[model samples]
Target chain A: MRYAMVIDTLKCVGCSDCVVACQTENDVPVGYCRDWITETVDGSYPNVVLELKSERCNHCENAPCVRCCPTGASHIIDGGIVLVTPNECIGCGACIESCPYDARYSHPEGGYVDKCTFCNHRLEKGQLPACVSVCPTNCMYFGDLDNPNSKVSRLLKNRKYKTLAPEAGTKPQVYYLI
Target chain B: MQEEIFVSGRDIPNIDPSLEIWHWPIGLYLFLGGLAAGIILFASIVVILNKEDEYPTTVKYASIIPPIALVIGLIALIYDLKNPLYSWQLYTTIRIESPMSWGAWVLLIVTPLSFLWVFSYFSELFPTWDLKFEWLKKFEQFVKKNRKNMAYLLVPLSIILGVYTGILLSAFNARPLWNNAILGPLFLTSGLSTGAAAIILLAKTAQERHLFGKVDLALIIIELGLIIHMLMGMYAGSEVQLEAMRLLVGGEFTVLFFGFVVILGLIIPGILEALEIKGYKVPVAIPALLVLIGGLIFRFVMVEAGQITRYLY
Candidate 1:
């Protein structure tokens, strides 16, 4: 099953609750985060437009991080969820340089690169990702993109959406509904 | 129209508006790797062409550089690694598509190969020295007997090592400045030029120095051509690449790239070497040292600036 995340930008309130949820769920360091809110403002003063959404690892199908890693530290799992084996990573930063989304950070304590894992632990227990489950605005959707009836697939099918850095050809699984 | 973008919750180190993942150590590693590659490449050619008798320093003396340089370069590389203890995992499996994997494997093979090459010439360099074990003595003899074969292997491996230095940077498609295709050839040419300069510094005779001075001059010209080619390609590329190229030209790195790397590193040295080749009296050390310094600064600028140019920014 191909997993994906669809974020509804219109419904997002820039509250950053999902950011906190991810931190608490994953035990991310105080100075770091796996998912974060981004605010984009466009146009001259009076005609300006603002867009807010949470950003994290795209878990790309053709992931550059996976391909560039010297060791098999970075890899995609059964559901297309990209994961890092902390013990195996040489911490060369090659994966960090290859990521288009700027999603990864070198773990200060573990001495390995770390990023969003799609809450794979919770997924094994048949639960949604922390960011999706904790989003107060209910704007985040997560499910198998291959299943036509899945919420993520249905929203992507029915809505006008865009992925960040589409020209990178990474085939990112994260989509933002405009 | 004026537009502004603000990102929050990005307090993470090294991944804010841009990435600053690689630092000075990586640049130093590239520089040393190139130097060693160039030395081995030229030394191997000297052996393969049967010019070892005439170019004793280039063939025998220069063989000492690859091992020392590779050891120090590898140390710098490991020091930069957050989890250096796990670096051995790099050999567990080779990923064909990964340039880093290729580099790791190539280095693994070439490091020992370089030591063996040097070991083969050990007894001749020190007539009093003797191998502690008969087996090692026999092995040294075997290596010495097949010196030409070893040189043949080193020819291709050294080239791979040289090109791999640049390919490591170019493989990072996310960084606009480093995503260019010319980096491989550019870095290799610079390495060869630096290698020749090292030989010029060490050569005993004026003939040997002048010969490599001419070689350095040619390599310098090619390196300049590649640099121009890279800039032109970037300027003609997508908006992102144009923005990346701007970092090198008319931006923060303008002076470093033009003044330090281009003029100080290439142009002056090129001219001096050209004059030297034409029977003019120029101290070989001046141009040779400048070339080495310039080669080093070029790597530093590339690494630092490439990290600053990103798709999102």
Candidate 2:
């Protein structure tokens, strides 16, 4: 089954609870983050809108990171989850540069490139991701896209959604409903 | 106890607060490319001088040095990769749109051509006196006859290879610090300077081997001029480009660019070249060594400074 995430931009308060939860659960380094928020304020003072986007590895179907990687260290796993193997990573950071979304990071100690894994560990235990479970406003939804009954599939079918940098041809797994 | 759920908007996800420093790769690429350019320049100079006795030795040594440098550079590049082995796949597919693809192809093409050029030069070193091996003699004659043509082609090919590294970095429009038309010329000039220094060093080491009569002063002057031109280009460019120059002048890379490249690499060599013209054959060994080190620093500073600046501001 193709797994995916649907993020509701309206409900997000830009609180970094998801970032902390992912880092703590994955043991990610302090300085490097696998997911982050970007706040783009357009227009002058009187007519400005603070558009905050919480982004991570889009887990693109056609990943440039994998193409640029000299080794098979970065690859797409089952369910369209782009994962980086710490053992195989040589810390070249080419994948980091290749990524348009800027999702990857090089671990200071390990010297290996890293990004979101869609909380694969939690998925194996048949549980919701830490970010989804902890989100107070219920801004994040995760489920199998192939399953007609899944919450993600229902939202995708019924709502108007958008994907980041679609011109890059990465086919991002993350979908947004305005 | 009142159960109060309080959350602040300041906590964002996925934004890496710390910045990354990427000077090492740029430094390494510059050093390797400079060395390769230096070797080719020296070989061309020897050929143009028409020093027949020295021709074979210079060509043979020059051709061989690039492959060794290329190997070392390739290793450094792969070592930097998250998966070094998958770099081989880059060669399997030919994508003209990507500079990385172009670089991979250039490396592949230049490696074998360099090896062949060297092989042709060193063929005479291997004795084929015995008439019993008729095929070997014929092969040797064929190599000797075609060697000049190969050398002619190899010179421009090597120059392209050397300068392409700069163009590759500059092509990324998003990287404003590297986005300069002067990059190609800068790389070309630095390549010649480094190439000359490398050859001079090799000539000194092979002095006992009686490889040649004397290093030509004309070639030395040309190399010095190239270094001056490179510095002038950096000084005359835009403000963002000038920032890169500042990094080299009185800033972070001052010691490396001025102290090493100018003082040791160019000035001393230029002085020695002038002295040689005035009937004083000052020993070139020491100055050549200094030039070699200076050339390496030139590349290091240029590469690092180009990347250190902020792209947004």
lDDT scores of the candidates, listed in order: 0.90, 0.65
Off by over 4 Å in 2: A1-14, A21-31, A37-92, A95-103, A106-178, B1-26, B41-57, B126-142, B202-246
Task: For candidate 1, give the lDDT of residue B66.
Answer: 81
Q: For candidate 2, lDDT tens digit of each residue in B162-217?
A: 77767666554333455566566666665665665556556534451222213433
lDDT of model 1 at position A160: 100
Candidate 2: Cα lDDT at B299 = 67
Best by the DockQ measure: 1
* Tens-digit per-residue lDDT, A15-63, candidate 2: 8788778878888776556666556555676876655556777888888
Considering every candidate listed, which one attains the maximal lDDT?
Answer: 1
**Candidate 2 global CA lDDT score:** 0.65
| Candidate 1 Cα outliers beyond 4 Å, as residue runs | B1-7, B12-19, B128-134
DockQ of each model against the real complex?
0.66, 0.12
